[model samples]
Target: MTDPARSALMSKVKGKNTRPELIVRQELHALGGRFRLHRKDLPGRPDIVMPSRKLAVFVHGCFWHRHQNCRMASTPKTRQGFWNEKFDANIARDQRNAFDLQQLGWRVEVIWECQTRKREQLSASLKKLLVPPENHR
Candidate 1:
Protein backbone atom coordinates (compact mmCIF):
# COMPACT_ATOMS: atom_id res chain seq x y z
CA MET A 1 0.00 0.00 0.00
CA THR A 2 3.02 2.26 0.41
CA ASP A 3 4.13 3.98 -2.73
CA PRO A 4 7.85 3.58 -3.33
CA ALA A 5 8.16 6.91 -5.10
CA ARG A 6 6.27 8.77 -2.42
CA SER A 7 8.24 7.05 0.28
CA ALA A 8 11.49 8.00 -1.41
CA LEU A 9 10.26 11.55 -1.77
CA MET A 10 9.15 11.81 1.79
CA SER A 11 12.44 10.56 3.17
CA LYS A 12 14.17 13.69 1.96
CA VAL A 13 11.69 15.89 3.80
CA LYS A 14 12.58 17.07 7.28
CA GLY A 15 12.38 20.02 9.66
CA LYS A 16 9.21 21.89 10.67
CA ASN A 17 6.00 22.08 8.59
CA THR A 18 5.33 18.47 9.48
CA ARG A 19 1.71 17.68 10.31
CA PRO A 20 2.20 18.03 14.05
CA GLU A 21 4.28 21.17 13.63
CA LEU A 22 1.68 22.75 11.40
CA ILE A 23 -1.12 21.85 13.77
CA VAL A 24 0.67 23.30 16.76
CA ARG A 25 1.78 26.38 14.83
CA GLN A 26 -1.73 27.05 13.62
CA GLU A 27 -3.17 26.77 17.10
CA LEU A 28 -0.46 28.94 18.61
CA HIS A 29 -1.07 31.60 15.96
CA ALA A 30 -4.73 31.55 16.85
CA LEU A 31 -3.65 32.43 20.39
CA GLY A 32 -1.73 35.49 19.09
CA GLY A 33 1.67 34.21 20.15
CA ARG A 34 4.82 34.80 18.10
CA PHE A 35 7.93 32.64 18.05
CA ARG A 36 11.01 31.85 15.99
CA LEU A 37 10.96 28.58 14.12
CA HIS A 38 14.06 26.40 14.55
CA ARG A 39 16.77 28.83 15.47
CA LYS A 40 20.17 27.23 14.79
CA ASP A 41 21.94 28.70 17.81
CA LEU A 42 19.86 26.60 20.17
CA PRO A 43 21.16 23.17 21.11
CA GLY A 44 18.22 21.27 19.65
CA ARG A 45 16.96 23.95 17.25
CA PRO A 46 13.62 23.77 19.03
CA ASP A 47 10.57 24.01 16.79
CA ILE A 48 9.27 27.18 18.38
CA VAL A 49 11.59 29.53 20.25
CA MET A 50 10.56 32.74 21.97
CA PRO A 51 13.46 34.80 23.19
CA SER A 52 11.30 37.18 25.21
CA ARG A 53 9.97 34.44 27.46
CA LYS A 54 13.02 32.19 27.03
CA LEU A 55 10.65 29.46 25.94
CA ALA A 56 11.23 26.53 23.61
CA VAL A 57 8.72 24.16 22.09
CA PHE A 58 9.42 20.78 20.58
CA VAL A 59 6.85 19.06 18.38
CA HIS A 60 7.64 15.37 18.54
CA GLY A 61 6.41 12.56 16.38
CA CYS A 62 5.00 9.79 18.53
CA PHE A 63 6.59 6.98 16.55
CA TRP A 64 9.95 8.64 15.85
CA HIS A 65 10.46 10.05 19.33
CA ARG A 66 9.12 6.90 21.02
CA HIS A 67 6.36 8.38 23.11
CA GLN A 68 6.04 6.53 26.40
CA ASN A 69 3.20 3.99 26.43
CA CYS A 70 2.11 5.04 22.95
CA ARG A 71 0.74 2.43 20.54
CA MET A 72 2.54 4.13 17.66
CA ALA A 73 5.90 3.29 19.18
CA SER A 74 6.99 -0.04 17.77
CA THR A 75 10.37 -1.64 17.19
CA PRO A 76 11.01 -3.14 13.83
CA LYS A 77 11.00 -6.92 13.63
CA THR A 78 14.47 -6.65 12.18
CA ARG A 79 17.28 -4.91 14.06
CA GLN A 80 15.26 -4.58 17.21
CA GLY A 81 18.35 -3.85 19.26
CA PHE A 82 19.39 -0.94 17.07
CA TRP A 83 15.91 0.52 17.17
CA ASN A 84 15.69 0.12 20.93
CA GLU A 85 18.96 1.88 21.49
CA LYS A 86 18.00 4.67 19.13
CA PHE A 87 14.65 5.13 20.81
CA ASP A 88 16.20 5.13 24.27
CA ALA A 89 18.86 7.56 23.13
CA ASN A 90 16.25 9.86 21.67
CA ILE A 91 14.32 9.87 24.92
CA ALA A 92 17.43 10.41 26.97
CA ARG A 93 18.67 13.19 24.72
CA ASP A 94 15.29 14.81 24.82
CA GLN A 95 15.45 14.89 28.59
CA ARG A 96 18.99 16.20 28.52
CA ASN A 97 18.07 18.91 26.04
CA ALA A 98 15.15 20.09 28.14
CA PHE A 99 17.29 19.99 31.26
CA ASP A 100 20.03 22.00 29.61
CA LEU A 101 17.53 24.57 28.40
CA GLN A 102 16.07 24.77 31.87
CA GLN A 103 19.53 25.30 33.31
CA LEU A 104 19.83 28.23 30.92
CA GLY A 105 16.55 29.49 32.44
CA TRP A 106 14.30 28.56 29.55
CA ARG A 107 10.79 27.19 29.92
CA VAL A 108 10.41 24.18 27.64
CA GLU A 109 7.21 22.73 26.22
CA VAL A 110 6.96 19.42 24.42
CA ILE A 111 4.00 18.59 22.20
CA TRP A 112 3.63 14.97 21.25
CA GLU A 113 2.08 14.11 17.90
CA CYS A 114 -0.32 11.68 19.54
CA GLN A 115 -1.49 14.36 21.94
CA THR A 116 -1.98 16.97 19.22
CA ARG A 117 -3.89 14.53 17.02
CA LYS A 118 -6.78 14.60 19.46
CA ARG A 119 -8.88 17.34 17.84
CA GLU A 120 -11.00 18.03 20.88
CA GLN A 121 -8.05 18.42 23.23
CA LEU A 122 -5.56 20.09 20.89
CA SER A 123 -6.78 23.63 21.52
CA ALA A 124 -6.64 23.38 25.28
CA SER A 125 -3.28 21.62 25.22
CA LEU A 126 -1.80 24.22 22.85
CA LYS A 127 -3.25 27.10 24.84
CA LYS A 128 -1.63 25.74 27.96
CA LEU A 129 1.71 25.98 26.20
CA LEU A 130 1.26 29.55 24.96
CA VAL A 131 -0.30 30.93 28.09
CA PRO A 132 0.76 30.27 31.62
CA PRO A 133 -1.53 31.55 34.39
CA GLU A 134 -0.83 35.21 35.03
CA ASN A 135 -0.01 36.20 38.57
CA HIS A 136 -1.66 39.60 37.91
CA ARG A 137 -5.27 40.04 36.73
Candidate 2:
Protein backbone atom coordinates (compact mmCIF):
# COMPACT_ATOMS: atom_id res chain seq x y z
CA MET A 1 0.00 0.00 0.00
CA THR A 2 1.05 3.57 -0.64
CA ASP A 3 2.05 5.99 2.13
CA PRO A 4 -1.12 8.05 1.70
CA ALA A 5 -3.34 5.02 1.98
CA ARG A 6 -1.48 3.80 5.06
CA SER A 7 -1.69 7.24 6.63
CA ALA A 8 -5.42 7.41 6.01
CA LEU A 9 -5.98 4.01 7.51
CA MET A 10 -3.90 4.88 10.55
CA SER A 11 -5.83 8.10 10.98
CA LYS A 12 -9.06 6.15 11.14
CA VAL A 13 -7.72 4.11 14.06
CA LYS A 14 -9.00 5.78 17.20
CA GLY A 15 -7.25 6.33 20.47
CA LYS A 16 -10.25 6.04 22.80
CA ASN A 17 -13.58 4.27 22.93
CA THR A 18 -12.37 1.72 20.41
CA ARG A 19 -14.49 -1.34 19.61
CA PRO A 20 -12.49 -3.55 21.98
CA GLU A 21 -12.69 -0.92 24.69
CA LEU A 22 -16.44 -0.67 24.22
CA ILE A 23 -16.81 -4.42 24.58
CA VAL A 24 -14.95 -4.35 27.87
CA ARG A 25 -17.04 -1.44 29.04
CA GLN A 26 -20.25 -3.32 28.28
CA GLU A 27 -18.99 -6.42 30.06
CA LEU A 28 -17.99 -4.39 33.09
CA HIS A 29 -21.43 -2.81 33.16
CA ALA A 30 -23.09 -6.22 32.93
CA LEU A 31 -20.97 -7.39 35.84
CA GLY A 32 -22.02 -4.32 37.86
CA GLY A 33 -18.57 -2.83 37.85
CA ARG A 34 -18.84 0.91 38.29
CA PHE A 35 -15.89 2.84 36.92
CA ARG A 36 -14.75 6.19 35.57
CA LEU A 37 -13.32 6.78 32.14
CA HIS A 38 -9.84 8.20 31.38
CA ARG A 39 -8.97 9.91 34.61
CA LYS A 40 -6.44 12.55 33.59
CA ASP A 41 -4.96 12.63 37.08
CA LEU A 42 -3.84 9.04 36.77
CA PRO A 43 -0.76 7.98 34.88
CA GLY A 44 -1.50 6.96 31.29
CA ARG A 45 -5.13 7.89 31.87
CA PRO A 46 -6.47 4.41 32.41
CA ASP A 47 -9.48 3.36 30.35
CA ILE A 48 -11.45 2.27 33.39
CA VAL A 49 -10.84 3.58 36.87
CA MET A 50 -12.60 2.16 39.91
CA PRO A 51 -11.56 4.47 42.71
CA SER A 52 -13.49 2.47 45.30
CA ARG A 53 -11.46 -0.61 44.49
CA LYS A 54 -8.27 1.42 43.89
CA LEU A 55 -7.92 -0.37 40.59
CA ALA A 56 -7.16 0.93 37.11
CA VAL A 57 -7.80 -1.16 34.02
CA PHE A 58 -6.14 -0.62 30.64
CA VAL A 59 -7.69 -2.08 27.54
CA HIS A 60 -4.73 -2.73 25.23
CA GLY A 61 -4.67 -3.67 21.58
CA CYS A 62 -2.69 -6.86 21.04
CA PHE A 63 -0.84 -5.62 17.98
CA TRP A 64 -0.22 -2.15 19.35
CA HIS A 65 0.79 -3.13 22.84
CA ARG A 66 2.70 -6.24 21.82
CA HIS A 67 0.88 -8.75 24.01
CA GLN A 68 3.31 -11.55 24.84
CA ASN A 69 2.59 -14.99 23.38
CA CYS A 70 -0.40 -13.60 21.47
CA ARG A 71 -0.56 -14.42 17.79
CA MET A 72 -2.29 -11.14 17.01
CA ALA A 73 0.72 -9.23 18.33
CA SER A 74 2.85 -10.17 15.35
CA THR A 75 4.77 -7.40 13.61
CA PRO A 76 3.61 -6.07 10.29
CA LYS A 77 5.29 -7.32 7.08
CA THR A 78 5.84 -3.77 5.87
CA ARG A 79 7.83 -1.04 7.66
CA GLN A 80 9.60 -3.51 9.91
CA GLY A 81 11.82 -0.89 11.53
CA PHE A 82 9.05 1.59 12.13
CA TRP A 83 6.68 -1.01 13.55
CA ASN A 84 9.37 -2.43 15.81
CA GLU A 85 10.19 0.97 17.26
CA LYS A 86 6.52 1.81 17.74
CA PHE A 87 5.82 -1.48 19.50
CA ASP A 88 8.87 -1.08 21.68
CA ALA A 89 7.84 2.42 22.68
CA ASN A 90 4.31 1.28 23.43
CA ILE A 91 5.57 -1.53 25.65
CA ALA A 92 7.92 0.80 27.46
CA ARG A 93 5.24 3.40 28.01
CA ASP A 94 2.86 0.77 29.30
CA GLN A 95 5.43 -0.50 31.76
CA ARG A 96 6.18 3.03 32.96
CA ASN A 97 2.47 3.81 33.39
CA ALA A 98 1.77 0.62 35.30
CA PHE A 99 4.74 1.27 37.53
CA ASP A 100 3.61 4.78 38.23
CA LEU A 101 0.08 3.66 39.08
CA GLN A 102 1.44 0.95 41.37
CA GLN A 103 3.72 3.45 43.12
CA LEU A 104 0.65 5.57 43.76
CA GLY A 105 -1.12 2.60 45.40
CA TRP A 106 -3.37 1.71 42.49
CA ARG A 107 -3.71 -1.87 41.23
CA VAL A 108 -3.38 -2.14 37.47
CA GLU A 109 -4.91 -4.69 35.09
CA VAL A 110 -4.41 -4.92 31.34
CA ILE A 111 -6.98 -6.64 29.16
CA TRP A 112 -5.62 -7.48 25.71
CA GLU A 113 -7.73 -7.08 22.59
CA CYS A 114 -7.39 -10.73 21.59
CA GLN A 115 -8.53 -11.82 25.05
CA THR A 116 -11.69 -9.79 24.64
CA ARG A 117 -12.52 -11.68 21.44
CA LYS A 118 -13.67 -14.68 23.47
CA ARG A 119 -16.76 -13.57 25.36
CA GLU A 120 -16.84 -16.39 27.90
CA GLN A 121 -13.16 -16.21 28.70
CA LEU A 122 -13.21 -12.44 28.86
CA SER A 123 -16.22 -12.49 31.17
CA ALA A 124 -14.52 -14.99 33.45
CA SER A 125 -11.35 -12.93 33.53
CA LEU A 126 -13.26 -9.75 34.25
CA LYS A 127 -15.10 -11.46 37.10
CA LYS A 128 -11.82 -12.71 38.49
CA LEU A 129 -10.34 -9.23 38.40
CA LEU A 130 -13.35 -7.25 39.58
CA VAL A 131 -14.66 -9.74 42.13
CA PRO A 132 -12.86 -10.52 45.32
CA PRO A 133 -11.63 -14.06 45.65
CA GLU A 134 -13.67 -16.34 47.89
CA ASN A 135 -12.03 -18.04 50.83
CA HIS A 136 -11.67 -21.75 50.14
CA ARG A 137 -11.27 -22.64 53.79
Candidate 3:
Protein backbone atom coordinates (compact mmCIF):
# COMPACT_ATOMS: atom_id res chain seq x y z
CA MET A 1 0.00 0.00 0.00
CA THR A 2 1.05 3.57 -0.54
CA ASP A 3 2.24 5.74 2.35
CA PRO A 4 -0.93 7.85 2.32
CA ALA A 5 -3.14 4.81 2.30
CA ARG A 6 -1.22 3.25 5.14
CA SER A 7 -1.34 6.48 7.09
CA ALA A 8 -5.10 6.65 6.75
CA LEU A 9 -5.52 3.07 7.86
CA MET A 10 -3.30 3.60 10.85
CA SER A 11 -5.16 6.75 11.81
CA LYS A 12 -8.42 4.82 11.89
CA VAL A 13 -7.06 2.50 14.54
CA LYS A 14 -8.41 3.61 17.91
CA GLY A 15 -6.54 3.60 21.18
CA LYS A 16 -9.65 3.15 23.32
CA ASN A 17 -13.19 1.76 23.22
CA THR A 18 -12.00 -0.60 20.50
CA ARG A 19 -14.20 -3.50 19.38
CA PRO A 20 -12.23 -6.01 21.45
CA GLU A 21 -12.34 -3.80 24.51
CA LEU A 22 -16.08 -3.35 24.15
CA ILE A 23 -16.59 -7.07 23.77
CA VAL A 24 -14.53 -7.74 26.87
CA ARG A 25 -16.45 -5.10 28.80
CA GLN A 26 -19.78 -6.61 27.78
CA GLU A 27 -18.69 -10.11 28.75
CA LEU A 28 -17.29 -8.92 32.04
CA HIS A 29 -20.51 -7.07 32.85
CA ALA A 30 -22.61 -10.12 31.99
CA LEU A 31 -20.42 -12.03 34.43
CA GLY A 32 -21.31 -9.44 37.13
CA GLY A 33 -17.94 -7.75 37.02
CA ARG A 34 -18.39 -4.12 37.90
CA PHE A 35 -15.63 -1.95 36.55
CA ARG A 36 -14.46 1.54 35.63
CA LEU A 37 -12.96 2.66 32.30
CA HIS A 38 -9.53 4.19 31.75
CA ARG A 39 -8.81 5.41 35.25
CA LYS A 40 -6.24 8.15 34.50
CA ASP A 41 -4.74 7.95 37.97
CA LEU A 42 -3.53 4.44 37.31
CA PRO A 43 -0.09 3.76 35.88
CA GLY A 44 -1.25 2.87 32.36
CA ARG A 45 -4.89 3.93 32.52
CA PRO A 46 -6.16 0.38 32.47
CA ASP A 47 -9.03 -0.31 30.08
CA ILE A 48 -11.10 -1.84 32.87
CA VAL A 49 -10.69 -1.36 36.59
CA MET A 50 -12.48 -3.41 39.25
CA PRO A 51 -11.81 -1.30 42.31
CA SER A 52 -13.41 -3.67 44.78
CA ARG A 53 -11.42 -6.57 43.40
CA LYS A 54 -8.31 -4.45 43.01
CA LEU A 55 -7.90 -5.75 39.48
CA ALA A 56 -6.81 -3.89 36.37
CA VAL A 57 -7.52 -5.17 32.89
CA PHE A 58 -5.72 -4.21 29.72
CA VAL A 59 -7.41 -5.09 26.43
CA HIS A 60 -4.42 -5.28 24.08
CA GLY A 61 -4.38 -5.84 20.34
CA CYS A 62 -2.19 -8.79 19.40
CA PHE A 63 -0.32 -6.90 16.68
CA TRP A 64 0.29 -3.73 18.69
CA HIS A 65 1.28 -5.52 21.88
CA ARG A 66 3.18 -8.26 20.05
CA HIS A 67 1.36 -11.17 21.70
CA GLN A 68 3.85 -14.02 22.00
CA ASN A 69 3.34 -16.80 19.48
CA CYS A 70 0.08 -15.28 18.27
CA ARG A 71 -0.56 -15.28 14.53
CA MET A 72 -1.89 -11.74 14.65
CA ALA A 73 1.42 -10.50 15.94
CA SER A 74 3.14 -10.90 12.59
CA THR A 75 5.36 -8.01 11.54
CA PRO A 76 4.77 -6.03 8.36
CA LYS A 77 6.84 -6.77 5.26
CA THR A 78 7.92 -3.16 5.13
CA ARG A 79 9.61 -1.08 7.83
CA GLN A 80 11.17 -3.94 9.72
CA GLY A 81 13.32 -1.71 11.93
CA PHE A 82 10.53 0.75 12.69
CA TRP A 83 8.05 -1.96 13.58
CA ASN A 84 10.55 -3.77 15.78
CA GLU A 85 11.40 -0.63 17.71
CA LYS A 86 7.76 0.28 18.11
CA PHE A 87 6.84 -3.18 19.31
CA ASP A 88 9.73 -3.19 21.76
CA ALA A 89 8.66 0.15 23.22
CA ASN A 90 5.09 -1.03 23.62
CA ILE A 91 6.20 -4.20 25.38
CA ALA A 92 8.45 -2.24 27.72
CA ARG A 93 5.69 0.17 28.60
CA ASP A 94 3.28 -2.68 29.23
CA GLN A 95 5.77 -4.35 31.56
CA ARG A 96 6.40 -1.13 33.45
CA ASN A 97 2.70 -0.51 33.89
CA ALA A 98 2.04 -4.04 35.14
CA PHE A 99 4.92 -3.80 37.55
CA ASP A 100 3.69 -0.47 38.92
CA LEU A 101 0.17 -1.79 39.31
CA GLN A 102 1.46 -4.88 41.09
CA GLN A 103 3.49 -2.72 43.42
CA LEU A 104 0.29 -0.85 44.21
CA GLY A 105 -1.33 -4.12 45.30
CA TRP A 106 -3.54 -4.42 42.21
CA ARG A 107 -3.81 -7.49 40.03
CA VAL A 108 -3.28 -7.01 36.30
CA GLU A 109 -4.87 -9.10 33.56
CA VAL A 110 -4.34 -8.84 29.82
CA ILE A 111 -7.20 -9.77 27.52
CA TRP A 112 -5.89 -10.19 24.01
CA GLU A 113 -7.96 -9.09 20.98
CA CYS A 114 -8.02 -12.55 19.44
CA GLN A 115 -9.32 -14.04 22.69
CA THR A 116 -12.51 -11.95 22.44
CA ARG A 117 -13.43 -13.29 19.02
CA LYS A 118 -15.44 -16.16 20.51
CA ARG A 119 -18.18 -15.12 22.87
CA GLU A 120 -18.57 -18.40 24.68
CA GLN A 121 -14.87 -18.86 25.24
CA LEU A 122 -14.48 -15.25 26.33
CA SER A 123 -17.30 -15.61 28.82
CA ALA A 124 -15.82 -18.79 30.25
CA SER A 125 -12.38 -17.23 30.50
CA LEU A 126 -13.72 -14.11 32.20
CA LYS A 127 -15.57 -16.22 34.71
CA LYS A 128 -12.44 -18.17 35.53
CA LEU A 129 -10.38 -15.02 35.85
CA LEU A 130 -12.88 -13.21 38.03
CA VAL A 131 -13.32 -15.99 40.54
CA PRO A 132 -11.04 -15.66 43.53
CA PRO A 133 -8.73 -18.60 44.26
CA GLU A 134 -10.27 -19.08 47.71
CA ASN A 135 -13.68 -19.54 46.10
CA HIS A 136 -12.43 -22.08 43.56
CA ARG A 137 -13.34 -24.99 45.81
Indicate which candidate wins on TM-score. Answer: 3
Task: Give the lDDT ranking, best first.
Answer: 3, 2, 1
Q: Native-vs-model 3 lDDT? A: 0.95
Better of 1 and 3 by TM-score: 3
The TM-scores of all predictions, comma-separated, are 0.84, 0.93, 0.95
Q: Indicate the residue-level lDDT of 20 in model 2.
A: 94
Residue-wise lDDT of candidate 3 within 1-137, one digit each (tens)? Answer: 99999999999999999999999999999989999999999999999999888889999999999999999999999999999999999999999999999999998999999999999999998998788746766
The best-first sequence of candidates by TM-score reads 3, 2, 1
Top candidate, metric lDDT: 3
Per-model clash counts, in order, read 0, 0, 0
Least well predicted 10-residue stretch by lDDT in candidate 1: 128-137
> Model 2 reaches what TM-score against the true structure?
0.93
Q: Give lDDT: candidate 3, residue 76.
A: 99
TM-score of 3: 0.95
Give residue 5's error in model 3 in angstroms: 1.4
Q: What are the runs in model 1 whose C-alpha is more than 4 Å off?
A: 1-13, 133-137
